[model samples]
Target chain A: MIRKGMIILVLVTLMAPCVFAQRVHIDIQAQSFKKFKIAMPAYTGQSDLAASLWSSCAKALRVSGVFDVLDPRGYITTAALAEIAPGTLKDWSLIGADYVVTGAASSSAGNVSMTFQVIDLSTSRKILNAQYTTQQGSAYRAVHAFVDALLESSLGIEPLFKTKIVAIREEEGRKQLYVCWPDGTGGQTIRGGGNLVLNPAWSPDGKKIAFVSYWRNNPDLYLLDVASNKVRLISGLQGINSAPSFDQTGNHIACTLSIDGRPELYLIDLATSGRVRLTDSWATDTSPSLCPGGNDLVFCSSRAGSPQIYHMEFSSKKVRRLTFEGGYNTEPACSPKGGLIAFTHLASDRQFHIALIRTDGSSMRVLPGSGRGDESPTFSPDGRLVAFASFDGDLYVSDLMGVAPVKITEGGGFQEPSWSNVMK
Target chain B: MKIGYRGFVVVLVVSVMFLVTGCAKKAVAPPEVEVTPPVVETPKVTTEMDMAEMVDPEVEARRILDQEMAEFENRDISFEFDKFNLTPEARKILAEKASFLNANPGVNILIEGHCDERGTREYNLALGDRRANSAKDYLVFLGIRPDRISTISYGKERPLDPASNEEAWAKNRRANFVILNK
Candidate 1:
């Protein structure tokens, strides 16, 4: 038995070179916002299941706005029949494909397993090879997981495909909060049966959502736990209690409260329910968005005679105005990186548009869009996309460099969209 | 002697006629003077009751309160574009309302602050709060009890007019009053 094992090991070592020679190397920097050309050849086993998984993976990558999936009709005829190893690299490179992803699936009993490899066509080197197993009906998730692995391996960034957007949808005059995948699928209503609901915000952990609803004839703040599907009222002050934003610590929430006869910013300790006033101005101050470190906050205030963005330090309570060019700049959403703020700016054309500015009050530019009421701008966790609601009540996602927005939500009456952080 | 007797009879008849006419004039003159005094005194008593019925204090208080509420509802104090400071006209209206509120100490009111649909909802909510409180502060300064007046902000959700034109926006950017109790 020892002699037989030694002979098998020698054979494996000889074959390993052939497998390594098959991979092509791909430069990581070649991947950009520009669509990367990817060729997805068919999987080896379970032809029908492999086809479906490949389609799902391609669709996910395409919807991510990162890949230009080549048409299958242009694929070399032998690309599908060829093995997933280096043998297929020649055919994919001939088609000018930058990257080639191939996989195989096998099912036994009630569980299914999938293995996929991402090959860099330029250097013939394998960049990613991952295997995942799931229940028979969860093949799509397995494929998505593989795609996420590929993205991370190539770009060194987390994939946003699995993230969800929580927004308010008004149906038949009753506003309900709904959560859906960023691609606008798998939507389910999370909260409803209120006179109106607005401003849904996601916590850093993505386990709880904070929003304002008019449940008891008054606008009250609520915290919804996504796991247990339970909601608890966070603030039900006598006056306007709305716009609850969770700080980075996840232990406190910053919200607007008018109980003192004027709407001002207040910080609520989530654990103790203790409240501390942040802004003590007779003028309007609300929509407090905490920066990444939770040490500073950017909000909209009317102290300058019109709604404009203002920055405030958490400890010293020192306030500085951040927006000046536009008189109607509001809804300040600080980026996760702590250097930029996205807001809704009312332009000279009397239309609301999405605009961005540096946190220090410099480098302001309006995102290009023709929508009249492009409002409530929220940044993606990576600060690459800005999701906002338009006049038609449709949620749109646009890049920071002002690309044409891609409409994510189909039906109307959708507003106050908040993108969740990367979910574990 | 006979001519003297005839002259005496004629003189006696003239004296008797004069005495009867004088007695009739004296009787009518006393009654005219007496009736004039009582007729003048009767209206003096009726005038007091008529004055009371015309202006009953409780009914007048309610009517005035109702009138003030109607005025408050119809005459919503408008602000300049994106402003909460009371305009001259707004202060004048608040002064008039303050007087009514002072007179009717048992009345309670609610100030509903509103804004145009131009700003963010949350910011507008704060602005509306400021607008409502501005009005309430003026009223309180004019001697109305602070507890008697409550404030609420509708933000830009509840607009007086839903149109997007300047006219509608000007009308919507206001602080309205609602009487809670009287």
Candidate 2:
């Protein structure tokens, strides 16, 4: 018994390094790693509806960058609804699949119901079984909603495929504002350059936009009525004025003004034209965004030696410092849930990259670290998608919830992206 | 040593005599000087003229201003949208202006930084300030006195071109020279 114990101890000691290395890698969760491949079979319903459902799921998964989906039609020569229930592993493997899934969609009583199952092709065993239902007109949206659930259950991060990214593009030296899918697909310019436009921002309702323009040859705030395609000069106070962001209630805008001869944040009532001064420091204060609660704002100030993000409460007019780890952190955008705030952090390399800090100002991390200059990260309504202006001066979208980032626009100098609130 | 001390005493006596002479002369000046014109002989000797006579300052200043405006119009000193950094062309033009200013004394300038009508008014004002200051720094580096130059930014609030196009934007993104005090 003594001899056997000694041999077992030696074996265990030899394997300790491998175990340590595995654990070290496991917890960080592959910062930029790809997820597993998933094969989703054609959802069975009416022929046209099944094809629609399959296409929708495929689009979501492909954009999510989480799943390498296999074509369901590529295998199972004789497929029926029953075959989707118990498919042979040999046929799935022949089609080069590691995992297989089957789903069926049906409509009854004005609601669409979908049931799906995920199976491991190697073991030929079911891993996940779930059901989703939604009203008739929202069937397409229901598929995306379902995919978010599957991704969370399997990979632990919900996907943000349905989010929209807003960017300003200058074409022929004309500044135009546009909104597009996160993947850079389906973009439409909502406003054209009859005037110089900068710093486009979305309201909490996602129905209105606020931006700065020199249409009147002075800095003025303009609110864009998205539905009517009309713009109104919301704020035209004297002196230098720009950088406008809406509060959570959509009733007021926080902006920067130099009326007192130094740039500072001012809260303006869109209805009353009544203004409240937020900061009185000598340093320039610009790039203001409401804290997730709408009661406070985070802005850039050069007062603390260099430009840094500062927080101030609206009611008490108290101030606090937010970032200390970076040389300069500016252009702050508070996340929807207020879990994290994104801002442009200047790295030692002299390149600016978008970084995240916990709303309480801890756990600072730069995205795609060590290279790539990125800035202006705006979160989606779901708080999962981060659309930022690429340092190469283009627009790119990334998922804060584990979806791989993809550059959405090319060339023409796009910057300062603000993601729209989810359409209900 | 005797000569040094005696020379000092002599210098003092002469200075005292000169002071008395100066006081007497002041009292007798004007009417007395006119009365003595017949007895006094004026010497015909060459006198030094000041260096300022070599250049007419007003004309030179106007010339320099015209040159600056021409250079700016020729795309010599232009900036990207909302940028204050001096481009190489802008630097070259500014260098020429600085040389002209250095050549002419008593010519002070205000570097006015302007931006295209794009960007927030306040941000443009700051940017304009930076642009003007950047030009001032370059001029000072080239031997213009810092006291003779000052700067201000007109962030996107003022534009040389009112129309919204590349040509207009290019024209408006500029640093202009304004003679504030000469």
Candidate 2, position A414, lDDT: 75
| Best candidate according to TM-score | 1
Q: Model 2 compared with the native: what TM-score? A: 0.60
List candidate 2 stretches off by more than 4 Å. A1-37, A40-59, A62-85, A89-163, A193-195, A369-371, A401-403, A410-412, B1-182
Clashing residue pairs for model 1: A22-A86, A23-A124, A23-A125, A24-A123, A24-A124, A24-A125, A25-A123, A25-A124, A25-A125
The digit string of per-residue lDDT tens for model 1 on B38-76 reads 445453444345554677789897797677778766778
* The candidate that achieves the highest DockQ relative to the unseen native structure: 1
Report the C-alpha lDDT of model 1 over A1-424, residue by residue, as the tens digit: 2222111111001111112333224432231446579988777787888777777777666645556689988998544532355575788888989888777878888767777777778777877766777667556567666666666666655767557788888787778777866655446666443767878999988888898887876778888877766789999988888888888878999999988877889999999999999998857888999999878999998888788899999889999998888679989999986788999999877789999999999989888753657989888787766788887788777767655576777768788889888886
What's each prediction's TM-score?
Answer: 0.72, 0.60
lDDT of 2: 0.68
Candidates' C-alpha lDDT? 0.78, 0.68
Which candidate tops lDDT?
1
Name the weakest run of 10 consecutive residues (lDDT summed) in model 2 chain A: A11-20
- Residue pairs clashing, model 2: A240-B122, A241-B122, B124-B155, B125-B155, B128-B153, B129-B153
